[model samples]
Target: MPTVPPTPSPEVITYTVRAGDALAKIAAQFGTTVEEIVEANEIEDANRIEVGQVLVIPQGAEIPILCPILWPLTMAPTRC
Candidate 1:
């Protein structure tokens, strides 16, 4: 049988926690699932996240961050 490769999923966005904000509210505001937020942040306890804690918001689709180092992928490879 021929082997099949798995598809890569989109990356999550990171958000710095703010005072008086809860995970539930953040998840709702981002239109994503809470479980996703928990998993992305690697929270041992979902309720334990605190202010200044960084959380990753798994976006439905990924938008790449612009940087000069990433330019090579768009150009043709030079002969070695």
Candidate 2:
């Protein structure tokens, strides 16, 4: 049997860039990171985003926040 790669989850969100918008701010609003956005969009320059540019925000890509109380219970970390 031929093996097939699993499709990525359709959890991406589209965001249009507005005037004075920066990757850092967008990432914060979407609970993601600038690095993830840059990687997802193949951005050549982090400092050079234009207005009205469409960006794909990958959901659940941010590093999870580890809870001290739950640290010993499971390997999975909870969202911050």
Candidate 3:
């Protein structure tokens, strides 16, 4: 039998919490959701993030593209 390589892992984005950083702001900045951040980090409190704390932000879905594939009939979403 031949040895096969492992599958590729999903891209991970890490963010360090700042003094004025909030989950909602962070989520909006990263195009993700606060719920996702909480879930990913298993956060007990949404407003308990500390300064310099690193967080794993999950970004899986591709941004919608808004390029027109066909006129009138179809509209392709453009990546933001």
Cα lDDT tens digits for candidate 3, 26-56: 8877788899999999999998999999998
**Candidate 2 lDDT, 1-80, residue by residue in tens:** 99999997766578899998999998987788899999999999999999999998876755334455754577776654
Per-residue lDDT of 47 in model 2: 92
Stronger candidate by lDDT (2 vs 3): 2
TM-score of each: 0.57, 0.61, 0.62
Best by lDDT: 2
Task: Evaluate residue 21 in candidate 3 and report its C-alpha lDDT on the 0 to 100 scale.
Answer: 94
Model 3 error, position 38 (Å): 0.1
Tens digits of per-residue lDDT for model 1, 1-80? 99989989766567788988888888877777779888877778878778998877886824334445543465665432
Q: Give candidate 3's error at residue 78 in angstroms.
A: 17
Residue pairs clashing, model 3: 65-77, 65-78, 65-79, 66-77, 66-78
lDDT winner between candidates 1 and 3: 3
lDDT of 3 at 14: 84
RMSD versus native structure for model 3: 6.3
Ranking by lDDT: 2, 3, 1
